[model samples]
Target: MEEEKKTVRAVERALEVLLCFASGHEWGLTEIAGQVGLHKSTVHRLLATLEDKGFVSRDAATDKYRLGLSVLELSANLWRSDDPSVALLPEMERLRDQLGETVSLYIRDRAERVRIQAVQSKQAIRRVATVGARLPLSVGASSKVLLAFAEASVREAILSDPAWPSQLDRSTVGKQLDEIVTVGYATSFEEREPGAAAVSAPIFSRSGQLVAALSVSGPSNRLTPDRMHEYAPAIMEAAHRMGTISG
Candidate 1:
């Protein structure tokens, strides 16, 4: 029993080390050690094992570590089986083509929103999404859309958290979520990334539960609020179609 408990604890620590990268894409050994509250030696050993398993990659030049292809491969497998990413790709692609902007699918993961699938535009200048990338649920259009439709408990916890980004006003967020629900979509301009703008609509399950968000993102100059409003119908239509197909 002692040996089994040790093994379980080791596994838990390794998983915690891997999860450290979710906040930022890369980390140094000491940084990860600090983040996970483990000693440098233990973190190093866990990193070595994760590196060997292709779950993490180390930058030879900078000596920083980032998540590896194995993580995306697992995400792809989930996408294929029952994640709705595969089923929704065609709609995402079609929306990208129609809007001439990058299209992405996002789902809530605890206090974050994760990009599960993306279709890039053909234009020379456009937004590009990295699959499996986790973003804060505070400022982006997709994140707001997901939050607007999320369960009341989940919504309250995030809004009430003292760590919530200072730039966001909770009362305003409340109004924005209400507007998103009333308008059937949400738009953000330079809210998170400078020069970035997006319009997102919620995708619902057959039972009317929110499942994901479908978004069209591009340069703020191009995806202006006026333009985003113009594109809203198309995005909402595609989101509805995606929900229909998945259902």
Candidate 2:
């Protein structure tokens, strides 16, 4: 039993060393050891094993280890496989064409918002939100909608984090989220990025749980307050359609 526990601790320490690389930093043996609180020899052995498996590699001159190409290839493959973003691309494209603005799909990762997919309109001037971009949960129409529909425990976890960055007045955001929950949709009047306005609705599963958010964004001048209201019904309809298909 003691041997088994020691083995588990070693594995956990090794994983901690690997996680230290996630900061996009090149780390030497001593640095990795210090970060994971393991002996230098233990760190060296673990790094060598990872390098043999093509998970880590060392620079020829610097002798510092970094994530290898195999890790990136594996990540790319996982990103493309039956992801919700890929499943909804066709629908997103149709919506972008109909609305003449960029359409985006986002999912919550704990307290963070990640843009999973997007379709851009062919307008001469366009607002583009990049796929795979991450944003704080306290800002943006899509993020706000996701937070409003999220489970109370999850929302509280986000609010309890002292490190979470909030730009707007927290009380105002809290009040606005109530309205979004009541209305079943959210809108941004030039919040988040400057000169960009967006309207978003929550996508719910067949079991009535919020799964994702769908949004349409464009220049603030083109998506004025009245225009956002005009487009809200269509956006909500699209979100419902996506939920039905996904479920």
- TM-score: which candidate is best? 1
Task: Name the lDDT of candidate 1.
Answer: 0.91
Which has the greatest lDDT?
1
Off by over 4 Å in 2: 1-68, 76-82, 164-167
Per-prediction TM-score, please?
0.82, 0.73
Kindly list the per-residue Cα lDDT of model 2 for residues 1-247, writing each as its tens digit: 4664335866777688788875646999888888888889989999888889888999989999999787888888876535678777888888898899999999999878988889987899888878778888887889989988888788767766786665556667667888999998888887787899999999987789787999999999999889988999999998888887776
Clash totals in order: 0, 0
After the best TM-score superposition of candidate 1, give how far the Cα of residue 65 lies from its true spot, in angstroms: 7.2
By TM-score, how accurate is candidate 1? Answer: 0.82
Regions of model 1 farther than 4 Å from truth: 1-9, 20-37, 48-76
Q: Model 2 reaches what TM-score against the true structure?
A: 0.73
